[model samples]
Target: MRASDRAYATLLDEIQSGSLPPGAVLAEVEQASRLGVSRTPLREALGRLGADGLVVQQSPRVTVVADIDAGDIRELFELRRALEETAARLAAVRGDAAAFADLAGEFAAVTLGDADGLDTYYALIARFDAALDAAVANDYLIAALRTVRTHLVRVRRLARDNPQRLAASVAEHRLIASAIGARDADLAAHATHVHLHNALESVLASLGGGTTTGGAITTQGAA
Candidate 1:
């Protein structure tokens, strides 16, 4: 990969993983040296992240990770609902039945008993997302979903420790996958809608009295 791509990937991972938490300052010279890249590529990477809305410029020379609160979470879910529901409906009609069926099986077997299981579950979600994107075969829709997913990684950490929400999410994904595999577009869309509703409610509640400053985010929304 090019140096800028390398820097972008590393920074993206750090931001998503909360290693570089919201409001964390990213000094150009320090970050460039830390990532072992020159200023030019580091600037390029930061520019990409800024475009993604993962970071923001406070002034000409200062940047910091962006913040997420109740409002941002709500907006994110709104877009997620529209994109994912459409994708599910289209995938139900045009996707490979066997692929969704296989994913359904994987979802059914998912275990979230420990950290390792959590990692496995998230990885499974990534696979399912890739399959959905490929199956839809719509470049425009995929692009929108990709942008939503970039912020989703950060939102997800809020619910990472919520066992009940995680368990429910697994079941929800299984149903959506099963509906798609069965070639039932209506069911797939309805399932996606229901899942998103539940997810938004859970996430808002996790926001604790709908306040961003309350405890660690308590609910995990869909991927």
Candidate 2:
């Protein structure tokens, strides 16, 4: 991989995993040395991260990880609802029913009692997302959804402590896949709406009754 690509992937993973939390300073010289890259590639990586809204440049030489609060989560969910609901409806009409049926069966058998099980469950969700993207067959919509999902990784990490919510999400995904497999567009869309609603509520509650912009949760700094 290109040095810029490598740096971007490492930084993106750190950001999503909370190894580099919000408002973390990212000094180019320090980060470049730590990542074994020169300043040029590190700057390129930071530029891409800024474009992704995962980082913000406070000055020509200062960049910090972006802050995410309850309001940001709400706004993200709003876009997620629009895109995912529409995707479900379209997939119901145009997707491969058998594939969704298989996914639904996998969701039904999901067991998240262990770390490995959780990994499997998340992999299944990834497959479901891939199937949704393929079934929709709209590049524009898929691109927009991809952007939403990028920030969603950070939000989702906040909710990982709640096994109850994760279990509920499994059931919700099953219903969505089942509805699409049955070719019921209305039901599929409605199910997606419900799932997103529940997910947003869970994430907000996990944030200690919803943090605000003025008083956001703070974590460790990143490179």
Global Cα RMSD, each model: 4.6, 4.9
| Model 2 per-residue lDDT tens digits across residues 33-127 | 99999999999999999999999988887899999987788889889989999999999999999999999999999999975998999899999
Q: Which candidate has the highest lDDT of all?
A: 2
TM-score of each: 0.90, 0.92
- For model 1, the superposed segments whose C-alpha errors exceed 4 Å read 211-223
lDDT of predicted model 2: 0.90
Residue 29 CA displacement from its true place in model 1, Å: 1.2
lDDT of 2 at 178: 99
- Could you tell me how far off, in angstroms, the CA of residue 12 lies in candidate 1 after the best superposition? 0.7
The models' CA-based lDDT, in order, is 0.88, 0.90
